[model samples]
Target: MNSRIVLGAFALTALVACKEKENKNIVEEIIEIEEVQPTTYAEISVKEGGSWKEGTREYIDGSFVNVDEMEVPEQHTDHSWYIRYEGPGWENKQTAYRLYLDWRNAIDIFGKKVDTLVLPYVGTDGFDSYHNEAPWGQDILKAGQSMGIGGYGRFTGDTIAHFNEVEKTHVKVDNSNSSSSVTIDYKGWKTGDVTTDLESVISIFPEDRFLKAELTPSVSFDGLATGIVKFDDIPLMQETSETGEWAYIATYGVQTLAGENDKLGMAIFYKTDEAKAIEGPHDHLVVFNPSTKTQTYYINSAWDQEKGGIKSEEAFKKDLQTKLSELDNNGKLE
Candidate 1:
């Protein structure tokens, strides 16, 4: 019953014609903006949920007045013992996720828009506990694949190093793109001989069940580990592209917002273009062996109660397939 259904589950380019290559100069002059702006953002975070109003804008994170702004606290109001920062997070109408400054890289699960646009800022209302939402939801990322629970790790051919100690952590919010992005920088830590300075940029779009994660290690290493919280009795269903191009690993069923063994799904979609292979040092492992140091993957969680009816394995699998297809065509033009 302590299950936290992590539904973090929630970018792009341009195309030009060969014939238009010669007219590049003219096109650049005509197109001043170059790209379209995102309409939706997690710009509103509320402490006292009510009619959206304006104030001095309490914290740097309390932007847009109504919600989703980061503000500097007048006093040290964050009372979370296990968590320190004001929970720099991003969300859409469907779901939300936050960071804990206490070492672990797992996300706090906030299923369903409590008040549609406002999320009661954790530290503001003197609410200082852990990730378990009172009646809202529970912690979601069960680390279904590996025990890492979406944490960063360095895996040699034989050994694995998970940086569980925190020297310091930096969390910030960015809305400069088509989607709202929360960047977490876990700096100055070590696991055995290898020290990992890792940065994870998680982007939550307007209406997405999954978030895209671009993880860059400050140092070179072998394989990077990305995984779901592995549960024993729940079981897992993983798939790999026959071409060795990508891998999809996920779980559904009984994993709901209320921990009712309903339909809640979590997954990691890894692109293996430059990968050696999606090797597993453990049963819960979803290792990505990238040709480069930067490893990119998609992480998401889905709740049946949060959305319409995505709480079953069959429906969840269908959604995962669509997500994988979208990831497969992320760059190329139709």
Candidate 2:
């Protein structure tokens, strides 16, 4: 009788354990199915990596990614979703920023997207930490960056320079008119810390003008700076029947999680003839830094409608000279 009781108890315990195990298995199976269901059928593509803010995931076939937040909305597709990630204080302790472009519009300018359309991520302190309200007004820049509007062909150059007065890294770019030639001095660019010297020269035609822009930055990663010069056939000014040409000159700093601090400086030089030719106003200097998620842009507001009425040449030279002087004071100009 005792043996029978013991056997009965053992059997009962085994049955209970089996039932519990079966229930647990069922629960686990359900969880596994749920986990796979969300992402299983999604098809996504990254047109350009690291172009948006840090956490940006997918860029639709032909759409724009929001630069301020580095977000791409999920389109209504059967099995695909795209997302960008980043918010306040994304790039280190500093606010994160990105440049956006409509892919369709950009493709029209470049003819095709190759290795040239992208600009490296930049981090600097002097750039504006705010966001632009309108995409139409923000048309001057792209996600990466493009240079020169196509037809006339623009120039681009980049180098790593130091602001000796203060400790900073400077990347200089020069844009020349169609007729002139530009030279870049790349002897001192390095992938490590410790400052160096860099210079970029641009030539322009008598009918065209030139502008020199620089971004002085402090970066977190350890890598070499890769600068690109590309001609983008995008129309910036729609006033005339002319589809203007522009060039995107860029220099990329190493990626970093800690925030970087720096300044942006630019000088615009106008050819005597081009300066004298009255045309709509244009931006003399452009700076786009994704780490800061901001752009420092300079425009020559002093335009003369009457031919030769404005001291365009004198004013431009004076402007460039003054900025160069400031750089000198800051020990940035070489």
Candidate 3:
């Protein structure tokens, strides 16, 4: 009887040890999965080991080098090729975007065909190689003279004024496991008689294609606005969320630079009370009210070629409605 009792005790101890080992293995697996998960990123790659010309707006004899922050040179402008992709770019698994970082100050989209971080390899082959389609993606928007998607500007009555008159511009990038952001400081921005400093933070998360922009001006002034570029063939669609606190101006059609057959959808979500919808010469403008406080808005794009992307106008509208409902219920997107 004593031997049997001892054996029973030993068996119980062995069972307990096995259970603990099982739990430990489960915890380790969870940790390993978390460690390998993909994340968002932001960066600025500039031409290094080179010097700017004394009298011309050119960067001479340098290779491209990545940096965390940069001050826009006085001579940097569109097609100057001083910066890779012409500015700072940020990306999540779903989408990517870059700012012109020069006088154009326009935002452009990079439509991804795969769900991986690809900005580091972009523009590495050539200055304008992103214009053509590759295995990853390409510069999908023609921006032209427009603000691109949700780029900010001063709505000068019938037109929009870009960052052409800023005294100085500085850009910095921040990245984390869950999100990434680009912060730009525009100093001494002049529009007609008004000159004020503006700081803009554009951020993206790991799961969504929409990017949030928070704009804070040093002083209150009218005409502060953001918008989606206008195409002659694509009609503008507007809708207010159920709560009427948020609204969006969107466009859907084959407007991508990839090709004529590639369809794209773009939208700008804004607070109803803070901004009024208006039509500008080049964009569908959301003109904000005069206020010194920071203003918040969102920009998003849907490409037909993206993985499980919105392929039809009906589906795109449904997705937009779902996003609107989310904002109405939560006052923010997840």
Residues 1-334, model 2: lDDT tens digits: 1101221243455445556665466545445433322100001112334233345443334331222112223321111223211111111110111211112101001010111111112111112211221211111223223221110111122322211122221212222212212222223333334333333322222221222222222332221122222223312221110111222222222111112321111122221211111111221123222221111211111222212322344553454555434433542221
Root-mean-square deviation of Cα positions for candidate 3 versus the true structure, in angstroms: 11.0
Per-residue alpha-carbon lDDT of model 1 for 1-334, expressed as tens digits?
Answer: 0001111211112233323457565454334323333323433233432222245323333222233333323222233221223345556667776644333444445565242423434344443432455444444544322333344555656644554554655655566445777666767767666666777777777676667777887876556776655555767777765455677777666644355554667777776664332445543456665433667777677776674536567877888777766655663101
Alpha-carbon shift of residue 112 in model 1 (angstroms)? 1.5
lDDT values for all models: 0.53, 0.23, 0.86
Indicate the residue-level lDDT of 235 in model 1: 74
- Full ranking by lDDT: 3, 1, 2
**TM accuracy, model 3:** 0.89
Off by over 4 Å in 3: 1-37
Best TM-score among the predictions, by candidate number: 3
Sliding window of 10 residues with minimal summed lDDT for model 1: 1-10
